[model samples]
Target: AQSVTQLDSQVPVFEEAPVELRCNYSSSVSVYLFWYVQYPNQGLQLLLKYLSGSTLVKGINGFEAEFNKSQTSFHLRKPSVHISDTAEYFCAVHEGSQGNLIFGKGTKLSVKP
Candidate 1:
């Protein structure tokens, strides 16, 4: 079974500042990685993925992450963020066999303008 752990439950930052949200995963087999964002009661939107490529992957809203196989980490980062970036971010892993995704509890990003 694969699982994701979001180290930070909440991250508060000032507007236009850099931010980083840590994510770690444990999987026995190869897995598809994803970062998703949710605004309030809205559904989640894909931010980025580490399907198969370079270690670095970029996503919407100026966010990016590096897939570290050894560390089993896929941390989200942004050089400069906006107040609107305040949302719930989730790190997920999909097991190919089960065709299901297991998501982290969530990391609430609060950006103060």
Candidate 2:
């Protein structure tokens, strides 16, 4: 079984400041990792994914994540943030030939001016 854990429940940052959302996963077998973002009153959108090959994966809206196999971490980072970036971010993992995804509780990003 695979599971995801978001280290922080909420992240408050000033506009234009950098932010990092921590995500850790536990799995007995190889897994596929993903990050999704959901704006207010909207469905979750794919931010980035890591299935194979590159360890560093880039996503929409200036977001990127590095897949660390040894540590079992895939932390998302952005050089700067905007007020529009305020939303809920979820980390998910798929494992064992199943198409199902196990998601974290989520981290709320609150960007302020």
Candidate 3:
């Protein structure tokens, strides 16, 4: 069984500042990595994903992540964040094509102006 670990439960950043949310996973086989964000009172939305090919993948809202197979880590980063960026970010991995996904505890990104 695979599992994801989110290093931090919450991250605080000032508006227009860069931020990184750490994520790590453990699996015996290859898996698909993804980052999803959920704003207050909203459902989760895909932020980025690493299905295959490139290790570096980009996603909406200027968010990007690197898939480091060696380390089994996929960390999400935003060069500059806005107050509107405040949300809960989740790191998830899907094994095989079962459509069953294992998600991290989630990291709440607090962007203060």
The 10-residue segment with the lowest total lDDT in model 3: 93-102
Which rank order by TM-score, best down to worst? Answer: 3, 2, 1
Candidate 2 worst ten-residue window by lDDT: 93-102
For each predicted model, how many residue pairs clash, with residues at least 3 apart or on different chains? 0, 0, 0
- Tell me the tens digit of each residue's lDDT in model 3 across 1-113: 88999999999999999999999999878789999999999999999999899999999999999999999999999999999999999999996667988999999999998
lDDT for model 3 comes to: 0.95
Ten contiguous residues minimizing lDDT sum, candidate 1 = 93-102
User: Which runs of model 2 end up more than 4 angstroms from their true locations?
Assistant: none
Model 3, residue 34: what's the lDDT?
96
Question: Candidate 2 lDDT, tens digit per residue, 1-113?
Answer: 67899999999999999999999999867779999999999999999999999999999999999999999999999999999999999999986555888999999999999
Name the lDDT value of residue 112 in candidate 2.
96
Question: TM-scores, in order shown?
Answer: 0.96, 0.96, 0.97
Cα lDDT computed for each candidate against the true fold: 0.94, 0.95, 0.95
Superposed model 3: Cα runs more than 4 Å off:
none
The residue pairs that clash in candidate 1, if any, are none
